[model samples]
Target: MSGAAFETIASLVRTRAGIVLGADKAYMLDTRLGGLMRELSLASLDALAAKLRAPGSERLAAAVTEALTTNESFFFRDGKPFEHLKRVLPRIAAARGPAQKLRIFSAACSTGQEAYSIAMVAEQLGLLPRLEVLGTDLSQEVVRRAREGVYSQFEVQRGLPVQMLVKHFKQEAGQWRVSPALRAGVRFETGNLLADLRHLGNFDVIFCRNVLIYFDAPTKSRVLSALADRLAPDGVLYLGGAETVLGLTERFTIIEGERGVYAPVVRMAAAG
Candidate 1:
């Protein structure tokens, strides 16, 4: 690929998809695109990259975006957040009254584990009855898999407790699939965090974990701002352990409990 073409595509990808591809990631991109290149009948990553750069292959850009997107997820990833959820579920339940309803958005939920982990926690905490779970991603392929609610044994093995695994997922033809009752509570869709999220409605909590680390500062700010908008007034926002609300937006106040989680300000006046 031409240097200009690589730079142009990288810029467009970073701006539109919030993906920061540095020079060191050239090897990573080649590795990730190998399958795509083979399927596209291209001889080289450079050629494949150039083909995706061609005009009228706009959908190809979406495919490339999907290729570059990382989707490593598992049940209750990093334990602490779910532990916090367990602690707060009852309090949030009381705040919610009869509705006792909860909305959770697992941004960039790969396959289904992270979102399902929330479902398991909700069920275990007795919040399953009226829960609404939305797991969104930029890739259609992963979204479809999340909707299926199926997982490989290796996927299930990581981060899942033995008893919960036995309770929540059932083996069907060798693959472990989340049960109907549990699966019904969750929905998956393709979405762009950089775009308007008004259609996603309000959510009591948003788990946008592990994703922001891949973006630059401006993209991070833009994503955090959009997430803030989709978040309900009293809702909480959760980021990956490595991520924080620091310097992103002033809309949220960090909740100082169990290693620093964030709660969105119900009132702008209070936030300031």
Candidate 2:
């Protein structure tokens, strides 16, 4: 790809999604955008870059951004996070009134596995009615699939235990479908982490795992601070094992004895 074309696409992605794409990932432009390019009848990355630069290409711009996003997901990914959630959810529920819902946000919840996993945990604890799980991703395609709640055989086998599979899913035409009961407890939507998210309201638990590693330092700190603002004072934030708040922001502190679990730092009000 030409340097100009590469920078154009890279800038679009970074500006729209807060993801930093370096020259090392320049090769991905072809591999990832080939279908979009062909579908639009564009001959090369340079051509696609030109189309993207043209005014009123909002739809094309969105398509390119979604194409570049990594939607990799599976049920119960990195077992420890779900384990800690199961232990903590009931306690959080006990502190609230019976009618109050404990909301959990699964940010960048690709294909809905992480959100459904939370639903399964809530179901197992008989807390489904008392809880709500909202999964959001930048790609409208994955969000649609997640709302439909169907998974291929290969998708189910990835990190999904047989027992949980049998308990929560029913096979239809050789694919696993999440039970209506489980589906009812969760919702999926298309969202951008860098955009204003206040309308989504606050969350008692936020799972924003694995996506931050793709961002630059300033973007990471910005996102962390935004996440802190959305988190309840007592809420827990789950980050990817490799991601941390140590250098990014002081809005969160690691939960002692927990891997990947963080608590929002409470600010004290000054005396009158």
Candidate 3:
């Protein structure tokens, strides 16, 4: 990637995705955009960036965004979090009841693993009806793969247990695959955390783990606060174990159990 093109695309990404790619990330850009160039049958990264910046090129912009969006994920990536989810399930189910569903958002869900993991747990607990899961990402490519829900053996092996491997995924001609019934209540969409999430609908629990580190402090604060606003009063927020809500957003209250968790700070709406 040329210096000018790199600057332009990096600026566009930071503006659109809230990700700050440093000067050292030039090599990464070259490696990634090279693939994008080949896939689109384009001449070069410069041409690709020009097309991205061209008028009436929403598709090109989306392609660039998806190409640049990070897609790292695995099922039950962290054991403690899923363990915590199990304990919280019954209480959340009782609190939500039948009329209202227990909505969960896996923000930055890379390849449907987190959303499908939640679905499997909820179904196993007989809480699927109480659960409606949505997985979202900044990349159109990732969201599309997530909707597909097919994983290779190596992909499923990461953070997945042997017992679960036998139970949830079936061997599809030697490749591990998620069952259809387990995926019935999930949806995936392309969304940027830097933008308004109102159109994505409200969620009772949001899993935005390991994503904020890529953002600057101000960007992280703004994004977390917005997520807090969209959260239900009693909604729980889950972040990576290495991450915390302290000093970022006062609108969330940290809850400690097997591992720590964050819940929305409940406020009473004014009576008319």
Model 2 residue runs over 4 Å out of place are none
RMSD in order of candidates: 2.3, 0.9, 2.4
**Candidate with best TM-score:** 2
Candidate 1 wrong stretches, greater than 4 Å: 268-272
The TM-scores, one per candidate, come to 0.93, 0.98, 0.89
lDDT of all predictions: 0.82, 0.93, 0.82
Could you give candidate 2's per-residue lDDT for residues 1-272 as a string of tens digits?
79999999999999999989999998888999999988999999999999989999899999999999999999999999999999989888988888999999999988999999999999889999877898999999999999999999999999988999999999999999999998988998999999988988999999999999999999999999999999989889999999899999999999999888999999998889
Most lDDT-accurate candidate: 2
lDDT of 1 by residue, 44-103 (tens): 656766776677878778777788789888888899999988887677777887765688
User: Is candidate 1 or 2 superior in lDDT?
Assistant: 2
Candidate 3: regions farther than 4 A off: 40-57, 257-260, 268-272
Write candidate 3's Cα lDDT for 1-272 as tens digits.
Answer: 67778887888778878888887887777677777788888887788778877789777666676677778899888877787888887787788767788889999998999998899889889887667899888877778888877788899889877787788778887677777777777888877788888887898888999998888888989989989978888778888888877788788878855344888888778999
Candidate 2 or 1, higher TM-score: 2
Q: Report the Cα lDDT for candidate 1.
A: 0.82
Per-residue error (Å), model 3, residue 73: 0.3
